[model samples]
Target: MSSRSYDIAVIGAGVIGAAIAAQLSRYAVRVVWFEAAHDVAEGASKANSAIACTGFDMAPGSLESDLILQTNPQWENICRALDVPLRRIGALSLAFDDGDSDSLRNLLNQAREAGIEAELIAGDALRREARTAAPSAIEALHVPREGIIDPIRLTVGLAKLAVLNGVELRCSTPVTGFRHHPSGAISHVVTPTGATAVGAVVNAAGVNADLITDAAVAEPFTMWPRKGQFLLLDRAVGHLVPKIMCTAPTPHTRGIYAVPTTNRTVLVGPTAVDGDDRGDKTTDGDTLDAVWARAERLLPEGVERRHVTKTFSGLRPASDRTYRIEVSAKVPNLVHAAGIRSTGVSAAPGVASYVADLIGAEVMELPVKSSVRESIPVIPRLAEIDTDVAATAFTARPGAAPDEHPIVVCACEHVTAAEIAAECRGPVPATSLDGVRKRTRATAGRCQGAYCSVGVSFILSAATGDQPGEVRHGEPGSHWETPVR
Candidate 1:
């Protein structure tokens, strides 16, 4: 096997790793990013709650809290730079009884103590703000800072920036083990494709982070998949729930809630179940039914079954104890950013900054680039364009080329041929059907690819120079073929 060398090796291409790579891009360093999956954000980063939290309910002195608190206020600027969509529609945690009301009060105090702007509302005011809330909800803790984001785009955006800034991205390359130097620090990252010598290693490998950590040193903790299932409602129901409607947290789990996505769909659920399988994304009717029932308690005006467009699941990297964000005790060159659970979306920026600093202070000292490309041009998403204005129709944003092709490929989401082609031919281009979907939302609309898959397949085929049959829906072997019913 051929060997290579780099200043740093990031072992996972999830949000955290991608963000770390992006942060590192600001400096002049040789960095290599690795992903076991076929693409970035294929793991938990793709299928998350998508809530950009304000750390309102987090423990005041914890690292998670501190990072989230620091990162929360910077989302507007970060999302803008990345061209990711963000909506600050706010969140409401409802109360059904006096006990629940008291919990809200305590949470309010916690929020204030953490410097998060929050308020407690009752009766008429709560009802006025949350029109779809259950009639039984007598009180609520309103956190206006809570919002939703396009998680997939956020991950891809970071990755794109990293690639543009010269970080080498290796998807479908899984790190099998590690090699050590004379001092017992890691010297190389072993992978199936090849082994690359490195100065430092970052184990940001999500649910499989524990396994990655164990490969480098003795396991400090174990990781299990904390499964969360969600039901996506039709975009037509988006107006009915404009705000994030949440329920009081239970000792074991944060109960079901309803959130509005940037795609204009209503998301309801996330039934938390701990398991051993890292690859289990299976969702069941019974668990989803229970989830819907719980969500109904928060949103009284029920979403019709017809509007339930899709049900999916994601696994959070749950650990036996607190989050591990320090250098490995034995493997001095390896850093652990594992055991991050549901709040990764909210805490990614902070984690990225902290890890970069740790690398600079502990692993290596690198000089900043004289010129840093801190932002990239936003891709012209046809859906976000003001097509209604005939005078300004088809005019691309600044730094983007004009859209000459007016042909709409995905009618459900207004995804145009140009948009699909652009994503398929970017710096970190889409190589599969799902990749295009994540970047352009082509197959994520009302029909959920039923109406647009063929069109997307053909466009993706044309863009990547792959045959129609060669264009897989996801990773290798996922061919563009219909199932035998």
Candidate 2:
């Protein structure tokens, strides 16, 4: 097999890795990103409660707290340039009981200590802000900086931008092992395909980060998987809550959150269950029942379960109850970015810069590349286009770009067919149905792909030259095509 070399190799193409790759691409260095799966951000990055955290709830001085606060504004800038959907609608942590209300006050103090701008809104003002709140709720902590982001689009944008900046992204390329030279530099990374030499390596494999490091270099670190499950509500219930809503934090987990995504849909749940089982995508009946009960307690006008569109789960890598991000002293060329849980989406960009600094200090001698471009192509938004303006343009030229006219592919989310087609063929093209779903939200609607799966499969097959039967769903080996009775 032919060998390849790079100044740096980043394992795991999740949001953290993609962000790091994007940052590293700014310099004159050969950077290679490896993903065990067929697509990037297929792991925890895609699954979380897609909230842009404001660092208010985090442990005041933790690395996560610092990174999240730092990355929030950076994400705004990045998403603007990439056309990734982001809304600064703000957040409210409601308090039903006096205990919860006191907790909010404590969190406000913590937010202040963490340098987060937060205020305690009480009584009628809090009631008016979130009309759906439980009548028992006397107050809330209003975190004005908290927002919602499209997690998948954000990760894809970062990866695409990194590729455009000259980062080599190889999917379906899982690193199996590594060989270190006597000088303490990792000389080669062994993958299923073959070995590739690199000067330094980053471990950002999420739930499997520890496994990857143990197998690759026998690095000692433990990663416990914490599962978070979420339920997507139809757009019909989108008006129930305007801004992202949450409950006061408990000792074990941050209680369920209700967030209205950029696409007019409401999301709820994310019950933090114990253990490392990542396979539980099927929403637990008990969990859903509990979530509904909690929603009623938090929002008296509470959402209906009948309005639920889809349910999914994500596993967070937890280690020693803290985010592990540091260069391995035992393994000189290896950098570990493990134990990044729920806040990962918000902390990704800052984590990238931090990792880039580590790479600059320890790895290859490199300079800033003059040829590296500073910007990436932004995805067009239907919501941003004025209907009257579009009509005038279309009237002038009836058949302009076929893509200009929106053909609704996912009725629940209003995603267009043109958007799906573009996502399937654009930079860092999606290869599977899930990849397309992540990139374009084609099959992530209320029907949960029951209605649009077939059509999207046809579109994906037509784009990738794959047979409809071969077009899989959520992951590879999970085919979506079967004749309906």
Per-model TM-score on C-alpha atoms: 0.96, 0.94
| Poorest lDDT segment (10 consecutive residues) of candidate 2 | 392-401
TM-score of 2: 0.94
Please write out the lDDT profile of model 1 over residues 186-251, one tens digit for every residue. Answer: 888888976788998888998888888778874567899989999999988888886888887766
Off by over 4 Å in 1: 1-3, 388-404, 482-485
Evaluate model 1: give its lDDT: 0.86
lDDT of each: 0.86, 0.79
Number of backbone collisions per candidate, in order?
A: 0, 0
TM-score, predicted candidate 1 vs. hidden true structure:
0.96
Q: Name the lDDT of candidate 2.
A: 0.79
